[model samples]
Target: MSTAIDIAALDPASRDAGAVAHYGDPVREQRLLEEGVGLVDRSHRTVIAVPGDDRLSWLHSLTTQHLEKLRPGQGTELLVLSPHGHVEHHAMVTDDGTTTWLDTEPGNGDLLVYLERMRFMMRVEPVDVTADWAVLSLVGPGTDDALKSLGVDEELDEPDTLDVPGAKFAQGTQPPRPSTIYRVASLGDKSATVAKFGAGWVRRVGNGADLLVPRAEKDRIDIPRAGLWAYEAVRVAARRPRYGFETDHRTLPAEAGFTAPAVHLEKGCYRGQETVARVHHLGRPPRKLVLLHLDGIATDELPAPGTPITLNERAVGFVGTAVRHHELGQVALALVKNNVKDDAQLRIGESTAQIDS
Candidate 1:
């Protein structure tokens, strides 16, 4: 909804080593991925407090992850999809019945509202803990060292998910007792490290590692920080689909390639249960998401988002994203019709790409 973004609004006092640059400026996003090992003032993350006994049941019914399997000091990634199975909000949930923190995009306020409207008889209470806290995320090579630098380190072989008043870590190796969440996934060379917490403590906690925040407020100053480009680069390589871009109001979980984690096929029923079950078990989905490699350069430029991709001049699908690669050439993610052969020749804008089998 925000058409124009003031880049510096992300992290004004940004200090990152080996940061990426675009248009002569440091791509502040490095704080989360490339340099996930550095300090960040993630003061904008939204935190929701769900307290009460039935909290687990209340959330299990709404999210995609299996809550019964999760223990305290642990967190899991989830997607709260619409009844029709379109992604409403991609979320990460952490709780063991006492309290749960929901971290999601700022645009998805409806999630909080929806939970409130439905909390009539449930003993659980959903409260917005945002004003009370701020969070920072780091996702790269030196995360462990950074945490150790902060004196938040533990020697557990299995990265431990810690419980902070407003924080959680989701993935890493042998972290500490203070680490709220931990996860293991395929990043570029090493997996990513995503940490979440309150906005107010950005400086107070990071200072343990001798890291300091030069900014006083999250909304008052503009930080030329990270955005979707850098975020998606690591996301795509991890085969993760972002909400609005890869999954949205019109797209379903299966087609977005998140069925395994987003849907419990054997579970009794859900919003779009019938349709999802039908396509999943009996019928073939109309379209399939596939990666593409444009065969040659375009005369002018590659097609923009939603431009029809053609093979033999017949419409097959559309381009979702195009990333120019130094090693692999121009690669893209596309939602091509199921009929398109794996070896089908493709036309994107004025160039040709292949459907690598």
Candidate 2:
């Protein structure tokens, strides 16, 4: 119910060309993302609880990922699509069997509520547990080493189960000491390691990091420089889809670049299962999610979020997210027509990069 991490103290960075936001602190989003890695206090994301006898089976019938195999201390990402298979929400869940916690944007809360309402007919009980927990994300180059030093062993190559800090769920590994470990295979050069805790300890855990006198003085983990905006740019570069951004109720998985391990086409009948399988096997996607590089696109700059993408003098797609890159120049993720998707030359008033197939 109460936000454990203070957003006011955390900086707010704009998406403007080279902006940055750290731990919530305001900074150049571009610098934060490219030059230095950062920590993001993603306390705002909501968590919903699924409990009861049919919890796994109940959710198995709703979400797009395979739920039967995920154990406690483990988390997996998923796309909750509308019947037509367009993404309605992108979800990451950590389950302990007894309670499967869904972590997603607040915007997706309505969908969770809707699913829960429908669950009234089943044995699983859905409860809003957003107020019950807090989460912090670490990203960028040194992420793996940082986590490995923090009692989490990265020795395991897969998402395995672990019991840590009182939660048992699937994770990437189990060190001599226990903790939940999830893999973030998004960004090209970066990865994410999420450490979660109940609302009561979120603050303590966050604050505790500052006091840790790791003999790791040898491993220069710049925990301080790593913040939210930097992490945002990383997501943009990785072309990792964000809810309410690249995806929406009308955006299909194929069109939004949903190629991650999240969606299991072989998984039997979920709400949008019919469309998911059909599209991958036989149907052609209407649009293509692309990464764009702009060169003086706008007299001022490239448009943000909803700016229309123009190729060959016609509107092809919309700019999902745009940010200035330190080295790569202007970069963006756009949704263009499937036909010209990869062939189209991106032209934002002259700035351009050919889409690579």
Candidate 3:
């Protein structure tokens, strides 16, 4: 039997700075990710802790999601939108009774600044805990088995009810709601917290969980490791939109397919509620996010992000993230004009892409 590899001992070439890009074989990593639980190091992501008697109410007034009644151990996502309804920042939020923990993509200093400025007379205090805390994800059908191996046997509560009003633009089937947070008494002698979120494309790739543990204890957890390459492949295949990858300064919640889970339409007045309500009630967004299957591209020859997607030499949209999937050949997520036909054959450089049905 092959022994479990320690991710901390990986060669420098296999990692991009601190994040593991791959483990010498991206295809094999992707296969392992699809077939069983693959441990992904997400320590580079940012973690913010908001502690106060007024944390929930203060957050409810500033963000797009309804959070005034957020119960402890309940997890959900929220978006910070510009006054014009443009997505500014996004975060995965959960409360642990005393403190509300929010994990988001790195480079979210602006989000912290905004939160500070919004605390007029509120009793909330938001602090950056990224340096002390680290995030790890267990992704695949075998997540429970892997957790069992680590001596974690906590039972998760059912997800909170997500019923809210004014979700008309949240078309198609909504993805699963975020999982309840569970406290793990020990993960190899280290205490940690686990929750299920969209870590591995929760819609298509279910049975995923995230571990929030102290940075010092991350290297001690023994498990087979996968890299960000495998995580991105599964994310792209699931048609899930990420913050930096699928969103830009001009992105609306509905445009990037975030209206369902990230936006609580019937909530009381918030920063960008007017625009979100107008767009939802009036007409379709200017652009729509879609998954595209790139034809005939080698693993090493995939197009870089921001590559222009065209139709008949006319630029229509741009690519976000591209990856080589284990089942699907080459696939990418793109934001195209809403008027673009569903059957339209688009081009990214010389490669032709068909919108995945």
lDDT of 1 by residue, 298-350 (tens): 65454445768898898878777655533345666777888899987788767
Candidate 3: regions farther than 4 A off: 1-17, 157-206, 296-299
- Best-to-worst ranking by TM-score: 3, 2, 1
Better of 2 and 3 by TM-score: 3
By lDDT, who's the top model here? 3
Ten residues in sequence with the least summed lDDT for candidate 3: 196-205
Q: What residue runs in model 2 are displaced by over 4 Å at the alpha carbon?
A: 1-20, 23-37, 153-222, 341-343, 348-357
True lDDT of residue 177, candidate 3 = 33
Q: Whole-model lDDT for model 3 versus the true structure?
A: 0.74
For residue 330, give model 2's deviation from the true position in Å.
1.9
Full-model lDDT for every candidate = 0.52, 0.55, 0.74
- lDDT score for residue 161 of model 3: 39
